[model samples]
Target: MLDLARIIADELAVKPTQVENALTLFAEGATIPFVARYRKERTGSLDETQLRHISERYDYLTELEDRKKVILETIAQAGKLTEELQAKIEACQQKNELEDLYLPYKPKRRTRATIARERGLEPLADWIKQLNLSKASAALTPEAARYLDPEKGVETVEDALKGAADILAEEIAERTESRAYLRDYFLKQGVFASRIKDDYPEGTTKYEMYRQFSVPVREIAPHNLLALFRGEKEGIINLTLDFDETEVLNYLESREIRTKVPEIRNFYRELIQDGFKRLMQNSLTSEVRSLKKEWADIESIETFEANLRELLLSAPAGMKPTLAIDPGFRTGCKVSVLDETGQFLEYQTIFPHTGDRQKVEAAKTISRLIAQYKIESIAIGNGTAGRETDRFIGDVLKTCDNPPIKVMVNESGASIYSASEVARDEFPDLDLTVRGAISIGRRLQDPLAELVKIDPKSIGVGQYQHDVDQKLLKKKLDDTVESCVNYVGVDLNTASKELLGFVSGLTPTIAKNIIAYRNENGAFKRRKQLLKVAKLGPKTFEQAAGFLRIRGGDNPLDNTAVHPESYAVVEAIAGDLGIPLTEIAKAGDRLKSVQLQKYTSDRVGLPTLRDILKELEKPGRDPRAEFKYATFKEGINEISDLRPGMELEGIVTNVTNFGAFVDIGVHQDGLVHISQLADRFVNDPKEIVKVGQVVKVRVLDVNEQLKRIGLSMRSRDRA
Candidate 1:
């Protein structure tokens, strides 16, 4: 077998030792984030993305090796495994290659080739296969006539030749080289062509653009491919692959037909065409399509991953006293107030949009709640009646001396979170709308903490998320969430179970245990106290302690990202400076000027040392950006009010491959195509905008009936 470590190292462009050490750490139950962050010395300081590639490639290679073993055993038992064949099978690096090599030997149901082989036609087939230009003129009639056997169904010269052709055709189709060539050609040269189905008229369905689409298989965008596949699956489009059949047949004939003799050359030509069309075309086409689908799934998943990361790491409004409103017209708005720690303090229902009398009372209730809670911010859900409610709140704040900072929150998945089991468990006595209100408020307070409670798919920041491979999508989204959660360290004292579960090396069960222990034993005072939690041993602590923050704890280092294993080094650094541990944060320039190389040892390196120093510089500081929000234009509250060339401020709600969707205070998000994102050409919309970014855009066009508002961020006048 090929050396797995060497193969992975070569593929990742790293040393074998690095791959080996990382694998060993992974084998001992270490995670990607932990290995990437903590074990820099052992793994040559490979980052998380590199470490993940190594791990995934290793697993795939191992699976391929196991399959090779199975194929070798099966062929050897069948008495057809020759030394050359064994070598070929063992050298295969892909599943498709191995399967192609084994197709001739694999057991299957009865077919035309099987019946022909059972007759006395094997000798004739072998003779025909060995026919070269030297023997091109040799008469095949005499050799094929000997295979006539009435008992076995070959009753004439033609019957015998037909059976021989069947066997040779199957043999040609099963050739590994032929299948590989066709597979490559199908992927590189074929065209993905589609048209509207008979039942679905043009421009009637969402996939009208794809009705007459034809793109090179290699050049098709991942999003476009996924859309075409979805259209085909929904029976709205008739999709097919277009390629040069004559060219393919010529290539196959060149491999088999080596003679200029018309009889022999023409004979092999007919057989090659029959073999390809009958045995290879459909099968290879499907395989190529599946391979393309996998590629598309990967690209789509990565897009989702990037978007989810930005959304998860969105800047928080900080822990502030907040009033959250889930706005509605007929049902009124459900209001909830939360303290600085995001604990629900009060709830009420207000109807400020129905009547003048109710509006006055509702305004009074809101004002009283703000005064009672000393609210520092107001979070209004961007839903039905959201703009009207924001206007109403602006009016109410006009009379106040110090009004709270009011912002619109994109409440994409708030309702999903409200009705979730996690939500129900937290607020059993409260209504779903009230729970939703609290979520909106908490989202403003800390987006990472509040948004973690809902499924990422429900967040609605992906393109064709539902159409992608569900398993791959879930894994990628989960990994993204975990990465974001760990990137911004969690608060050990106040983090909910859902947020805590994404911590390095912490499972859902262990997260629940930590919360249980915290609830029962009061707040954790030190990072070391986590060892006492049930099912949380030393290893879990080692993996999770660095990412878990305990603010205002007994030890100041506990609040930073310094791992517990490195506390000794920190203490020694403080001792060298003759300052107490509590004053470590105060020694600003001294800490930076300290020689990082002097502290290097077997367990620590410059990377780890630099990280420790940086963490010490900003202990317990958030890695997210400063809080900012977009203020919607007051009068432009509906799509009907939108006009082309009007400039407006908005927040980006979602970013896709082709464009970004901006919530421009019209209750309908507008599309800013990639071409209009900036003055220069843009390859990706993500490079220009993110999920929570505030962008200034000009309305390029508006369709009030269709609720489509085209927007542009270019500096020039709208096109």
Candidate 2:
């Protein structure tokens, strides 16, 4: 096998030393976020993306190497392996190529060729290879007549020749080079077309748009390819591929049939064409589809990951005593009150949307809660009865002594979390809807901390998320959550087990143990106290400590990203400045003025020193952007209220490859297509918007019957 690390380095445009160093750290169990943030010097300052690519590619190569060993061992034990065969297998770079090379020797059930050999036709097949009736031959039949064995089921010379043809066809199908050529040709030239199955009704499904679709394999978009495969799987459509069979037959003949004898050459030519149609076509076509699906899955998973990352890193509404409402029409609204730290204080019921009398009582109840708890903000779920409830609350605050900031929270995954095992454990006795309201409130308090409790898939920010490979989707989403959580360091004293589990090197078990310890022994005073938690050893602490912040701890550096090992360098810097460590916060200018070279040692470099100085300037600062929210236009409560050329303010609910879906005060989301995303040309929707962005758009068209709203940001920006 080639040097896998060196090859990955070339592919990613990084140095070999960087790959080697990163591999060493990965072997030592370093997390991607930790290595990207702290080990910049060792990795040549590679970012999180480069590090993740290295990790994923390295995994692929290692698995490939292991597979090669197994293949070699299996072939050798079968006594079919030769020195040249082993070299060829070892040099194969792609998994598909390796599988193709091994197909001829792979174990199999009884096949036609194998059965023909059993009928004592092997000798006759060898003779056919040498018998080129090119110059002169009495007749091919005369040679074939000698091999007829009636007792062995070969009744005549014709039957014997038929067995020889089957053997030749099998040989042509198994040639590795031919298989590769056909697979490549199918990818480049094949045309995929799907039509409504004859038995199904014409307008029975959402796949009607794809009923007459036809596109070349190479030109199909990733989303369209996935949709076509899904449509075929559901039996709504019959899918077929069109290709030039004559051209394929010609190529196979030129490569396999060299004999000029009109008689023998014609015999081989028939078998060659039969082999392509009967054996090679279907097999290679399936392979090409699988390869395309795998590529499409990768692209879709990446889009999902990018969207989830943006949603998770969205700005928070910060800490405030808040009142949250999960609105409903018939069931009335479920109200939950949260204290400043987001602990559920109380829950109640309100019938704001029921009638005039009920609305009056709802307003009085809301006013009392605001006055009693000193609530600073109100979060209303963006669901049924949401607009009506917001209007009700706005009217009530008009008479109140102090009003709170009202926000319409995207409640996509709140119900999923409320019904989850985590939610049940957090609020065992509360009603499900009440728990959902509490989640909405906490989502406003801190998005990263609260959203971590729910599965990223349930958040509903991805495009074709369910259609992609589940294992890849889960892994990428998990990595995204971890990156976001670590980017905004977790508060050691207040973080839940869900938030702690995503910390670098901290397992779910360790997170539970920390929470248990804190519940029993009180809040952690310093970073060193983590040693008291069960199963948290030196290595775990080393990787996780920098990301865990202990606010108001005894040692001030415990709250910053400075690892425990680098405390000595910090103390030395404080000592040279003639100040106590606590007063180091007042000497930011002096810390910057210090000669960084003088502080470097064998174990510490400029990278480490620079990070330390930067931390000293602002310790434990949140990396998320300041909070902001979109305000929906008043009186636009439903799809019927929208009109062309009406300007509206909306929040982006989901970003996809072709467009961004925005919530413009109607339950139905409006689409801002890529062409209308900006005044200028827009190649990527993500470049102009994200999952939780607040964007202004103009209504282009609204179909009330279809409940579809087409929006345009280009015209709005110019206006």
Best-performing candidate as measured by lDDT:
1
Report lDDT per candidate.
0.92, 0.89
Off by over 4 Å in 2: 130-139, 400-402, 716-719
Error of 1 at 424 (Å): 0.9
Model 2 is weakest, by summed lDDT over 10 consecutive residues, at: 130-139
Question: Candidate 1, residues 574-688: lDDT per residue as tens digits?
Answer: 9999999999988999998999898999898999999999998988899999999998997999999998889999999989888999999989999999999999889988888
Cα lDDT of model 2 by residue, 1-719, tens digit: 87887988999999999999999999999999889888888998888999999999999888888889999999999999999999999987789998988888888888778888899888887778766423455466887888888898888988988888888888889999999998998899899999988777778788888889899999887888888888899888888888889888888988877667778778988888877888788889899989998998988887888888888888988889999999999899998999888888998899988788998898889999999999999999999888888888888989987799999999999999999999999999988999999999998888889899999989988877888889988998999999998888999999999999999999999999999999999999999899899999988998999999998989999999898888998899999999899888779688889999988887678988898898889887877787888888888888988989999999999988788999988888999988999888887788999888898989999999778999999865473
TM-score of each: 0.98, 0.96
Residue 587 C-alpha lDDT in model 1:
94
Write down the RMSD of candidate 2 (Cα, Å). 2.1
